[model samples]
Target chain A: MKGIIYGLVFFVSLFCSSFAVAIASKPIVVASTTQIADFARQVAGDRLIVKCVLAPGADPHTYQPTPDDVQMVLESDICLENGLHLEGKNWMSTLATDAGKPIITTTDGIKPLAISSEGEMVADPHAWFSPKNVAVYVNNIVKGFSQLDPDGKQNYEARATLFLQQLRVLDSWVRQQINRIPTQRRILVTTHDAFNYFCTEFKLNANNNFLSIAPVGWSTGAEVGGGMTPERRRKVVQSIKESGAPALFVETTINPKQIREIAKETGVKIGGELYSDSMGPEGSAGETYIGMMRENVLLMVNALK
Target chain B: MRFLLVVTIWVVIVGGLWGYIADRDTRRQQITAATPMDLSVEGRFVIEVTPTFSTEKDPFALTTSDSSVPPLTVKLNGMYIDTHTQEVLRGQTLRYEDVSGVLSGHNEIYVSASPPLSENTLEHGVRVKLYEDSTLVVDQTVWADQGALVSGTISFNHSADEEGSHDH
Candidate 1:
C-alpha cells in the first residue's frame, strides 16, 4: 500500500509540472467584463489564455471582484477593461489597481458621449455595444497586446484584421436594417448609458439618462443610480413625447418595470430588450460580442422600423 | 481524484460550447490587406487649399519680394463633382484666386454643387490646390479598403521648406 501511494504521488508531480509549463508558455489576458474579454479573446487567438473576471450571467455594472478574480488579475500580464466608467467606478478601478498589471481601456481614443444635457460632455464608455465602436476597441486591443508580446504581434494583427472586417460588415448590415425604420421613429430608449456608441454608430438618438452599462440610481436602492427622481422620469417622458419617438427600448441587464411604466404612460410600445451589459450565457444568440450586437440591431429594426 | 477534477475543468474550458469558442480561436485569418488611409494619428492636409499658381495677378495684388514674380495667383475651380463621374458644375463651381499654401488655415472649403449632399456617403471628399503654384492634389479619389483603412502618401506641394520654390 505504501509503495502504490508513492507511485501515485510521483506520477501526479510529473503531470503537474508539465501542465504548469504549458500554461506559463501562453500570454495571459484578464478582462474586466465579459464583453471586453470576449473581444480580447477574439483578437488574442491561441497565443492568449483569456480569463474573464465577470462570470457568465454576471452583471458587470454590479460586479465586485472576488479574491479569485484578484488572483487572476495578479497572475495576468495584461488586463483589458471597458473604461468610460462602465464597470461601476470604484469597484473595477480597485481591481485594476490591485492587480498591478498594465491595463488597456478599450475605449481610449474614441470620442465619447457625455451624459450631461449639453450633448458634448463626459466620456460614455459602453462603446463596445456598437459594432463600429468595437472596431476602434479592436485596434486599441491589438496595439496593447503587441506592446506586451511583440513576438505575437503578427498573430494579433491577423486576428484583429479578420474581426474588424466582420465589424464593418456588421455595421453596414445594421445601417441597412435601420434604414427600414423612418427617420422620425429612430429614437432609442434603454436602461443605462450603454447604447451611446450604438446610437452614434447606427445614427439613432439614444436616451439613456442612466447612461451606463452599469445601472446607477440617483441614490442607493433606486432602480438605477437611485435616479428614479420625479424630474428624471419627466425628462424621459418629455423626450419621448418631444421626439415623437413612437417606441422605447430596454436592456437585458436592467429590470423592465422602469421601462414598462414609462412605456405605458408615454403611450409608446416597448420595442424589445437589448443585450447591453453582458452577452448571453452560452447557447443564446448574444453569446459573442458580434452575435450580441447583431441580435440587438435585429431586434431594434423589428421594433422600431 | 484531484487530477480528474482538474481534467474535467480543462474539458469544460476546451469542450462543450466553450469548445466552439476555442475552435474559433484557431480559425484562420481571412481579412484582405487594406491600403492604409491617407489619414494618420497626426497627418497634415490643406483643409482650405489654395487655388493655383499663375502669372496673372489681381489689380490690387501687392508686390512683396520680387515684383516680376509672375504675380503668383491661384485660380482654383473647385466643385464637388459626382464621385463616380468627374463632371464640373456650371453654377455650383467654386472659384478661389492666387492663394498660397502657407496662408492656408483649417476651414471647410465647400463647393455648391448642383446636387447638395443632404445624406451620408461611405466616401466624402474635399479637393484642394495651391492657386499661385498651380499645384493640385485630388482627394475624392481616395477610398477606404476592406477595413475602412485609407493609405498612400498625401503630397502637399508646399512643405515648410518647399515654400517659395516650385518642385522645379
Candidate 2:
C-alpha cells in the first residue's frame, strides 16, 4: 500500500506539471512601435503577450533596433510593424527578417498621401494621423492575430469591432470640432509634413499644391531638417505668407527651434505642441493613440479658430 | 499474498513511468510539428495616366486636368477563393488573410473599376507579395491598360514547407 501511494503521487505530480505548463504558455507578439503595440493589446487581450520595440515618445523614423530587440524577435511568435519605411532605416524589417519571424505591416491597406521631396514624389508614411486610417490598422491587426492563433479569432474580432466603433465616434467628433473653424482658417502649419492625411481628411489644405504647409519634409533622416531644402523653405514661407496662416505648431518628437524660427519669420504665434511623430509619454493625456489624436485636434481647433 | 502485492506495486510503478515518458515525447513532437495555419498576401496597385499630347503643349495640362479629375480608385472584384473578395483603392496596399484550407494549388485575383474607365483614362499596375508565415515566398508585378480587366495568379501547395509562385 505504501509503494502504491508513492507511485500515485508521482503520476499526479507529472500530470499537474504538464497542465501548469499548458496554462502558462502564451504566444509572444512584438510590435515595432507603441501605437501598434497598443492596437495589438486591444485585440489580443490575454491571449498573447504584446511588447513594443519603440517606447512611447521614441521617434519611429529615427529609431534603431538593439541586439536585445533581435533576441526578442527570435523568441516572439509574431511581429508587427508599420511598413512604408516608417522604421527610418528599416530596422524593424531587418530585425524580423533576421530572426526568421512572421511580420505583419499594420499599414497594409491604407491609402497613403504622396508628398514631393527633392522634386520626387514619395508616399507619406504617417497614416495614423486620421482615425479612418487607424481603422484599417485595427483590421490588419485583427487578421494578423487571428492568423497567429486561430482559436482566438472570435475574441479578436469582438474586440476589434468595439475598438473600431470607438474610432468611428472619434472621427465624427473630429469633424464636428473642425467644422467650428472657418474653412479658410483650416490650414495646419506644423514642423514636419506629417499631417497630410489629417489635412486631406478634414479639407484643411489651402490648395492641392500645398497640403498642410510645414518647414520640414516628410522624414527626418540624415538630410538637414528632414530634407527641408532652401527651395522648400522658400516655398513654405511663400505659402504661409500667401495663406496668412493663423498659427504655427511643433511636434512632440521633433525639436521646436526650426518651427519657432518659422513662426517668428512668419509673425505667427506658436499655437501649441502637437503630438506628431510619436504619441505623448505615459501618464499624459495623449498617452494612447486615440487620446493623442483627440488632444491634437482640440489644440488645432483652439489655435486656428 | 505478499508476493502478489509486491508484483502489483511494481507493475503500477513501471506503468506510471512509461506513461509519463510517452506523454512527454508526444508533447514534444506536437510542439515541433506545429505549423502556421495562415499566410499573408500583401501588395499595392497604382494608376498612371498616359498623355495623348506632347509635353510642351500639355506641360501643365495633366496637372490642371488631374485637379478636375476625381480621386482615381480600384477594387478587388473577385478572387478564386470566395471569401477573399474586397475592394482596394489605387496607391493603397492590400493585405488578404489566406487561411489554411481556403487556398489551394492555384489562385486568381481579379480587379475591376466602377463605372468603367476609358482606354485613355488611365493605366494601372499591381505588385503582389506572398508570405508563408514570416518568410517571403513570391513577389510579382502585373500591368494593364485602363478599361482592361486585370488578373493575376498565385500558385502553391497547402503544405507549410512549399513556396508560392506568383504569375503575372
Candidate 3:
C-alpha cells in the first residue's frame, strides 16, 4: 500500500514539474502600446506572452505608468516601445531600464518625419500610419523576439514574412485606392499632425509642402487647449481654403470637438474618424495594424474621391 | 518496519525531486540548442551630387528647380532610411550598422535626392555596400539623377549550411 502511495506521489510531482517548465518556457513580452502588442502577437504567435501597457484607445502621450507596470516590466523578458518620444514622459523606457529588461524600439529603423512645434523640431512617432513603416515595425519585432527566444527564430521569421506579404499587397492596394482621387484633391486634413508619413507615402502631399495641416502639432503634450495655436489654426484654415479640401478627419485617441469646429469653420464635413494614435478596440474593423490602415484608406478614398 | 517505511518514503521523494530537476535541465538544454542566433544586416550608403547648370533659358522657371541646394535622402524598402539635410559640397557617406529590419531573404534599398535629382546634375550618383558577418556581400552604384531613384536588393541565405552552403 505504501509503495502505491509513493508511486502516485512520484507521478503527481512529475506532472506538476512538467507543467511548471512548460509555463516558464514561453518568454514574456511587454509592449508599451496596444499597437505594438498587436505587432508582437503577430510575430510571436504562441511563442511569447504579449502584454500591452496602454489599453486600446488610451492616450499614450499622457499615460502614466502605474506600480503594476513596474512589476510587469520586472517579469518581462523583453519590452517593446514605439520610441521617438511617443511615450509622453518616457515612462516605458524608465520602467524597462529600472528592471534591467531588454527594450526594443519598434521605430528604430524608420525615417521619422520632423515637425516644427513651438520653435522646436520634433520627430513624429506615428510611423505606423504608413504601411511601409509598419513593415519596419514588424521586422523589428521579429528581431526582438528572435533575440529573446533564439529557438523561435524560424517561427518568428516565418510569421513576419507572411505578414510582410500582406503589407505589400496592402501597399499596392492603398496606392490604387489613392490614385482614384485626382491629384489636385488628394488633400488629407486631420485633427493632429499624425498623417505626414501616410500622406508622403501616398503622394497626397504632391506640392512638397510639409504641412499636414492640423490644429494640433506633432504631440498632444502641449498645454490643454493650447496645442492649437493661432498660427497653426490659420495655417490649417489657409491650407483647407487653398486646397479646396472636401472633408476633414478626427482621430480615435483625440476629442472630435476640435476637428468638428474646424470642419464647421472650413465648411467641409467631417469625413470620418481615423485610427491615429491608437488602433480600434478588439473585434472592431480597425483592430489590427493592417485593418486600421485599410479602414483609414477606405474612409479617405470614399470621402475624398 | 517503521524505519523501513520512513526510508522508502524518503527515497521516493528524492527520486521524484531528482527526476523533476533532470527533466527541467534536459528541456532547457533542448531549448538552448534549438534557439537560433539573431541575424542583422549592416551597410554603408554614399551619395555624390554635382551641381549642374540647366539647359533651360530660365533655370528658376522650372518647377523642379530650387534656389537652394536640396538635401539628399534615402529610403530602404519604401521607408526613409536617412535624410541628410546638411549640404554636401563634394559628397557624403553614411554608415548603417546592425540595421534590425533586414530579413533572411531579399532586402531592398532605395536612394533619392530632394528637389528631385535633375537631369542637368552632373556626376550625381549613389553607392551602396552591404555586409554580412563583417564580410562584403554587395558593392554597387547607380546614377541618382538618371532615374531620380537608385535601388538594389541584397539577399541573405542564413540557412545555407543546413541546405548546402551557398552565398548570395
**Best prediction by lDDT:** 3
Candidate 1, A1-305: lDDT as tens digits? 44445555665786799899997988898888778888898888878899888876666766667888888888888888888767776466677688677888888876777665234566666677666567667778888888899988888877776676566556656767778888766777665656666676667764433233222222111244344778777877776666565567776766677768877887988878788788887889988987887888888888877
User: Where does candidate 2 chain A have its weakest 10-residue lDDT segment?
Assistant: A215-224
TM-score head-to-head 1 vs 3, winner = 3
Candidate 3 wrongly placed segments (more than 4 Å): A1-17, A207-211, A216-219, A223-243, B1-168
Q: What lDDT score goes with residue B72 in model 1? A: 19
Rate residue A90 of model 3 by lDDT.
89
lDDT of 2 by residue, B110-163 (tens): 332221222224444555555555556545555544323333343434333344
Q: Candidate 1's residue-wise lDDT over B114-153, tens digit each?
A: 1111122343222343333343433332223222222122
Give all candidates' CA lDDT scores.
0.59, 0.67, 0.70
Query: For each candidate, what's the DockQ?
Result: 0.03, 0.02, 0.03
Taking every candidate in turn, the Cα RMSD to the unseen true structure, in Å, is 16.3, 16.5, 13.3
Off by over 4 Å in 2: A1-24, A216-219, A223-239, B1-168
Model 3 Cα shift for residue B51 (angstroms): 36
- Model 2 - which docking category? incorrect
